[model samples]
Target: MKLILKNIGLLKQAEITLYPLCVIAGENDNGKSTVGKIVFCIIKAINRYKEDLQESKEYQVNEILQEIYFKFRRALPTDDGQIPDVLRQLRAITTGPANLPEQLATVREALEQLEQSGTETRSTRQDIMDALEQIQLITDQPEDTRQSIENAFNKVFASEFDASLLLQGAKTGTIRLYDGDFLLIHLEVNAASGATLKGDVDPINIKDVTFIDSPLILNHHDLLIRSQSMLDVDRKPGRSLGRSYTTLHTKDLFDKLKEPALPNDLFATRNKALLGNIQKLIAGEISYDKSSRDFVFTKNAKSISIKNTASGIKVFGLLQILLANEVISKNTMLILDEPENHLHPKWQLHLARILVELIKEGIYVLVSSHSPYMIEALKRYADRADLKDTSRFYLAENRTIEDRNRLGEIFDVLTEPFETFRQMDAEDLRDE
Candidate 1:
């Protein structure tokens, strides 16, 4: 899938055709992280809409049309109290109009009155006009109108309300996700009102999408607190603290750990090598202690609590556990925001290798980072004959003009910091 973003947050415009292994590199405050967050929110929104569609009961075309008409009527003026009467007549006409000509005349007169009422009536007039068009269509092309009403309802109701909240200082923005030449989803956001207008070529199912944010290293204390709170349903809060990728990932991991451990044989075969690589890097085996309600790391004949582990270890430990439990598999779309955080240069290189292994296993990986070492490692791994075709790199800059058309060539952007250091060194040697 290719994600096209315009006027979203710090990203004035960007078009990313996601590869199996994708890297986004940029300096600080250049919207690299924002790109990951936006993609995550879009996927989550599509999943939420699909869930709502499943839960909602079916509605008849006439019923939906009537409901829309009533909603508009309520917003219309009631100065002489004649609006209600007019709405009632309109409602009667919707249900098998006995005299189409008479009913149409009544609707026209009402619309004319609304038009004369000025600005307040503008939206109401449009609503009536839309209803009239649908009503006329129903008389001739009943099926076509039915489909139209269904499409309208889907567009309006399928909107992701919380997506607007993720966007900051976004006066206006558009997100488009396409599958090949066909558009799967299109979202438009209004920053002032936090309203989203959504359109989809077809329904989206995101059951296999996974998003990880910048704080890839999970805090042991926070995880323990959240775990304890989950035990007491009455004390557990309903509101989210902050919907960062880490928070969601932690919650999901906790939930999975709470479930009975899957049989050893049920583990996914594809993650075996990845999990082994993580264990080798950390030099420890991670296991959940159900009795103590904590993660235990066993290494060199000693057992230690995960809370006492290094920050980098904890990050890999999280992935290790998820892989062990079969939560991540070949079909997963893994999105990692700043995976280089809390890891040393050596570990960053190891992470790059693990990501290469994942890509080889058919897992789609998206990474956003500002670290030169991380990007260099990725570049090295991407140069392999097998990965060359599946890897892509993007440079996100804060400049007015964005070069999104360029793909797979970001060597200059990745080595920018080193070039600055080299220039400084050359000047210092010349002065000496």
Candidate 2:
């Protein structure tokens, strides 16, 4: 899927085309995380209400059921339609396979009897409630009132990150990027009392924030990422005492890249292969224990752990967790910004390989990057004779998007090497 952003955060206007193996490469403070957050937000919004991250079986079930309910509600006729729908849904839940018409007829008869007897429909209401209790679908209560369910959903869907540092969107002139999906991962800023907070400092139109589909939005306290913040202590409880930062729980992402695992069934309930491939791409690994509240990098492997890894690896791990179950679905659009940051050249190439694999498998990948290493990798892959034609690149600099067609023109202009290749005889080429 493509992601277009306008008037959001540091992005005055930016667009990134996601390839199966896309990369976002630019200088530091260029809003790479902003892009990722936009994409994450989209994912969050789509599966927002689920009691699981985008990757859980229960979350998927509820999502599917929600769609089914929406369709069912839409299909009802006019007049006594809503009442019939309620009855039919209740009936279908309690008594399997009852038609809407049949359920409506029963409900109407009960109402008529109550009206004729000049009595309240208390008994009839009890009957409806009993039927609802029997239904195998979702619970009979309103969804918003279910705190336990909402909390569970929030935990499951929240991205694994110090989301609180995400700042509020600045008011800027509107600029439209690609028409792709955008995910809102986090929103937070510091306050006047020296407290970093979640949400915008000033009220802004919530409608101003829009993604083509529902996107996931996370929140964090501003100091969550800073070393001196109390949030840090909360994040690593054992670390509150004197502890060596080097001994903190961390993992070798490179090693994980070499030996991938099938996603936990909870995460990859649908497409195991796709999840496997993604695990291979980023070298998926996570660290978690009963004592800890969240997963850390596996290499560090300590509750009071503190160690350093590149921002790229941290971001990749976060993405892997967010996207663990996404690959199995056809409708998902993966939007990323500057995935090449903090990655070594070899890892960049490895990421490229994974992106190409996903594209070939029919997944839409959208990315924004300024890294020449990443660009060269894609060009190398795209230039190969056997590569599929699904590859395309966009340049987002100088406040305007330059398509690959323009680059192709530039390549044509710069092509004196064609003559050199042609002039070199097969014997010379082979000898070299």
Candidate 3:
């Protein structure tokens, strides 16, 4: 898989080829996470394209249902507060698998009957009739997947989203993804018109993309899961419902945790083995306690709350949960942003080895980090595991570099602190 970004945020132009295990080490705010975000957005939009079209139609249908229901309510007796039969039927249609066209016909006939009954004013009847027009408009043509993906990309980026953040006074920008020769996503941004998408989506190529921004997400599982459920049921057409920051990644992981594990086939067996490795690393297994609706670490025949568990333990713990649940599959691409965040340098190295080994199991891994230990450890394990060629590295500073030999360059940039310390030591020795 390859990704090309032109004039995206601080990254003026970057053509990143995603290998089995890809790492990009960079300073903060260089849009290192941008590649992962774009990958996530494209995968989601393609996979959910049908659902988006259907859901948009459903939303449009619900608006008419709601309008008709309110019209009946205003005409009904207020003292009893009883819902009219028409309102009941409308509510039922929305609550179940609706035959939307048939339902629309029924609603239109009902409206006509109400008009003849002399209960509604002509203007009110006209209002009801006007809303019904949207039914035809919505059902007439398909909702464009390009628009859906563009909207999703915007939401995924949130506060950091700016399609036209060009550099060198460039007027246009683009983000494109390709699987070999097939184009999966193509997003073009005109400096004036914001953003537009034009490309073919290779829907079946990528099964899924999971971004683990932080293991700390486990702490906010309850809130994220609840919100995700709401979004699934009735998400409004705009971004006004969500916060300034993107919640898709966090909410997605939390929501997936509650889903049933995949079938226990050969694929699942491989996942189980990886899960075992993670459990061994932490010297414990992380399991979800259904009764308490929480995650717990079990070791020495005792289970303890993740809150009480060390943060470093939670890093591997997150991987343990994902692998156990079969969320990280062969076709799945796992994106980790600074996973070395709370881990010790020793664990960081160990985690790197685990990640490299994970790629060997047929999963794609993209890691963005500032840890030299983690990057070096990954390179070592990737070599020992005979996956050195499939392991790619990048240095994201002013421009993103795409080359494996540049791994040392990435380490040098990350290890500048050691150089600074060495210089400080020399200065102290001279003073002595």
RMSD, every candidate, angstroms:
13.9, 17.0, 4.4
- In angstroms, the error of model 2 at 305 is 5.2
lDDT to native, each model? 0.61, 0.41, 0.72
Q: Which scores greater on lDDT, model 1 or model 3?
A: 3
Query: Which candidate order results from sorting by lDDT in descending order?
Result: 3, 1, 2
TM-scores of all candidate predictions against the true structure: 0.64, 0.39, 0.81
> Which lDDT tens digits does candidate 1 get at residues 85-177?
666776776566346577678667656655665534556666667766766655554233323323332332223122433346657777777
Residues 193-289, candidate 2: write the lDDT tens digits: 2111122122111111111111111111112222222322433345556422210011111212212332333254454555566555545444322
Q: Which candidate's TM-score is highest?
A: 3
- Give every collision pair in model 1: none
Task: Write down the TM-score for model 2.
Answer: 0.39
Off by over 4 Å in 3: 74-86, 95-137, 143-171, 180-184, 199-204, 222-234, 237-245, 260-270
Better of 2 and 3 by TM-score: 3
